[model samples]
Target: MFGRPTDIDCDLWRTDGALLIENAISSDELAGLREAFSRCAEQAKPDWLSGVRAGTRPAAFFDLPDPMGLDDRFLEIVDHPSFYGHLMAFSEGQVIFLSPQFRTVPAAPLSYVGWHYDVHRESTPLHMIGADLSG
Candidate 1:
């Protein structure tokens, strides 16, 4: 599912508070995930779509905070062998598995999440796992 974690991976996480694991999923898995995402987006609530399409400027991306209910694949990934171990390693075996969110960035010439802070302003450290399905 993923390569074994390295000392460097842990070091990066400790120092920068972020780490990148490349090719974490097989191409076939990626394709399936992309298809699932598209299907869910197509059937998304109008309000969700509207929030994404809102704002004067083109939106950078939109997130479905409660995406686990949208598809079975979303639930399958919670204990997936791919990156769960790495997550545990980074969190010192004190990891809490929150329902993963689904975020989509529409195709645009300049697709970027501009300057802004996340919604929650708590000081508690948070760990995030993100996958780029763009082929």
Candidate 2:
């Protein structure tokens, strides 16, 4: 559905506000996302990317040998016009970047991850309900 704002009498930005949903992206946009991810992988240097150690559940990290280089792609995704718009909409206009991490799930015997919240332990209580613009 189109998410274009209408002349409706509602303020969805208030705390505990109800959201007006919309299907923003088309199937083509979904495909583009998949392609971009694949291209990123293809362009990445195998040796520069390494797996993370197994965690309590299952997890592995990609050690971008060059943070600067890998960061370019990460920034691309975060700043991409279309992609960023979609992300902001889904997050209800609340999203911020604290840090970035890359992880890869290789074949069996290597891929594993546990369910966990991304919030920092120290920031608990003030639970990350909405995005915090500052890092």
Candidate 3:
């Protein structure tokens, strides 16, 4: 059989429409993701101040809901081929390589995030709509 899948398909780079692929990751991957996060928290540089401080706004901290123990699974789902295909379909082949992925965790005592576009620069086209996804 083929080795564990690694590369994401190239078709996910469209810039026009929006695509939201739901429930992409597997259950096992979710567990792995959780364990990895826990390990990171344990090993994180505690001396560093949380959030933006001093000249900037401080960062926010929160916990992710884990009832299904699907942290890693969720991540895996997003990275799956079908999700990438959807993203590619939205982009329409105009792929702007940015960060590897976007992630958010809604912890208890949940804070509200304001509705805003991903880009605020003058070059960002006025017609570029923002895509918001939540579970």
Candidate with maximal lDDT: 1
Highest TM-score: which candidate? Answer: 1
lDDT of 2 at 58: 30
What are the clash counts of all predictions, listed in order? 0, 4, 18
For 1-135, candidate 2 gives per-residue lDDT tens digits of 223332341344343344433443456665765565556556754433333222323334343333335434445555555445544655668978754545455655524333336654445422213354445
Task: By TM-score, rank the candidates, best first.
Answer: 1, 3, 2
In TM-score terms, candidate 2 sits at: 0.37
Q: What C-alpha lDDT values do all the predictions have?
A: 0.67, 0.46, 0.42
What candidate 1 gets wrong by more than 4 Å, as runs, is 1-4, 45-61, 106-135
What's model 1's overall lDDT?
A: 0.67
Candidates in order, TM-scores: namely: 0.61, 0.37, 0.42
Residue 125 in model 2: shift from native, Å? Answer: 17
Looking at model 2, report the run of 10 residues with the lowest lDDT sum: 50-59
Candidate 3: segments with Cα more than 4 A from true spot: 1-23, 50-59, 62-79, 100-135
- On a 0 to 1 TM-score scale, where does candidate 1 land against the true structure? 0.61
After TM-score superposition, the amount by which residue 88's alpha carbon in candidate 2 deviates from its true location, in angstroms, is 7.8
lDDT tens digits by residue: candidate 3, 1-135? 111212333233233233333455556765777776665444442422333344233244323334224344445544366456555444564646443432333353433233225654445443333344543
